[model samples]
Target: MGARRGFQEAVLAIVKKIPPGKTLSYKDVAGRAGNPHAYRAVGSILNRYDAKKWHIPCHRVVRSDLPAPRPGLYFVYAVLCGNGAIYIGQTGNLQKRWMQHRNGTASDYTRRYGARQLFHYEQHGSREEAVQREKWLKTGFGRKWLKREWKAGRTRQAGGTPGGYRWGSKRKLHLLKKEGAL
Candidate 1:
């Protein structure tokens, strides 16, 4: 009974720690609660979260990799978008990186892109592999890469207004007239 109470308290604390545009998977929550191997149990706990869509972002949790669990993946995707998590990048120490973003020490890219956490993550081997995968995701798809691959919903617009002192066609004509070239 005492142990069960402790778990409940842990769950509530973790949920509270989740920021406005961030998330944590069942696996991540469970692991942080000192269970490391309780993804299924964590999911069960989340499934019964009475607060549901209000207090907890139950939809952000997702199954890792392809051939996902269909409805579950779609649900997670929706939550990610709602939470402003427009991109998905991986790091060797997934948990550590998650902490960095949550604590406001996020990467330049994440800062510029307005991305946030929205679910848990599954381990995908070594850190090198994860870095390589991130690089590939950023490059292989280009614009599609940012959208389909990285899940970047927001974009930095390409060009801004020209400065008041740029050499344009009119400027070139004026210069030629001054030099007697036209």
Candidate 2:
């Protein structure tokens, strides 16, 4: 515990030196603390400390990779939570966003609802299209349509196809491959 506490103190000291409007990645902080591989530990330390009291800018320590939306095919995806509720969201990187949800860092809704798996997705040419689709999916008519489609596909009979998916116990590829879906 002494060594661990030393590392935490080192992280806070490093963060305290970050210039205003500047940032350092978690990896950078860990490396400065004499442990290149303890990046996650740096993040943990930052999250556990109070920046105001410590006079440390903990928020300046961020992930090595920024969250700028990648330019590519955007998607409006749905996750079927363990609670039998659906979550609608739009993202440029579906896989990364899905991972965040799976890790319970994506949103309070997913974390609270226990997001189970990717229920559905629709690819779009532009961000606007994905945003529009996501907005529509949150409406009464859109939700009804998703339910109707899910019922038609009979996805309750679980087991993944080819793409990695799991809804409830598992998810089906055939349902995802259906027209107008992903």
Candidate 3:
């Protein structure tokens, strides 16, 4: 437990050094945390930490490449608009991006439609991959897949702001597979 706590502190310290709008790869974070080969463990530490409680910027840690192979870094996300439309996007930082949408800084479309809930999302390896996936999700076939796969009733309520929704385990795993995110 002492060793785990030490690693957590090291990870948190490194994460806090990441500036807003900037990011570090999990491997990079692990190296800085004094264990060059602990990239996966670094990711686990970040995932387990409560960013809200500690003011740690876990979102700043991404995969070394675009569209990460695992499902813990960058993402392609779908937001349910108040007008019943779905908005697709990609981001290295999910929490920050959601905040931007809620605050009207993300896009004109989201501002106009009003983001009501988080409908779907898939993790990617890197920013480039996430961008590509976001493009696909905006296409007709992708839209059809989303409509068929997404259960509107299962979407977590947004409550008029970002940061209110947490991903349910089953839905998250299902989306990862359906979107070829693995």
Candidate 2 stretches with Cα past 4 Å from truth are 1-70, 154-182
Per-residue accuracy of model 1 over 69-119 as CA lDDT, tens digit each: 222121111112223544456644434454444334556645444332333
Least accurate 10 contiguous residues by lDDT in model 2: 160-169
lDDT of 3 by residue, 70-135 (tens): 454787888877689998888777655765665456899877766655656677777888888889
- The digit string of per-residue lDDT tens for model 2 on 1-182 reads 99888888788888888764334556668989989899888867766665567676554444433233467788788788857899889889765676566546789987776555576777788999999989998999999998898879843322112222222112322332231122
Order of candidate numbers by TM-score, starting with the best: 2, 3, 1
Model 2: pairs clashing at backbone N, Cα or C within 3 Å: none
- What is the lDDT of every predicted structure here? 0.45, 0.65, 0.65
Count of backbone collisions within predicted model 1: 5
How well does each candidate superpose onto the true structure, as a TM-score? Answer: 0.42, 0.48, 0.46
Off by over 4 Å in 1: 52-54, 57-105, 115-182
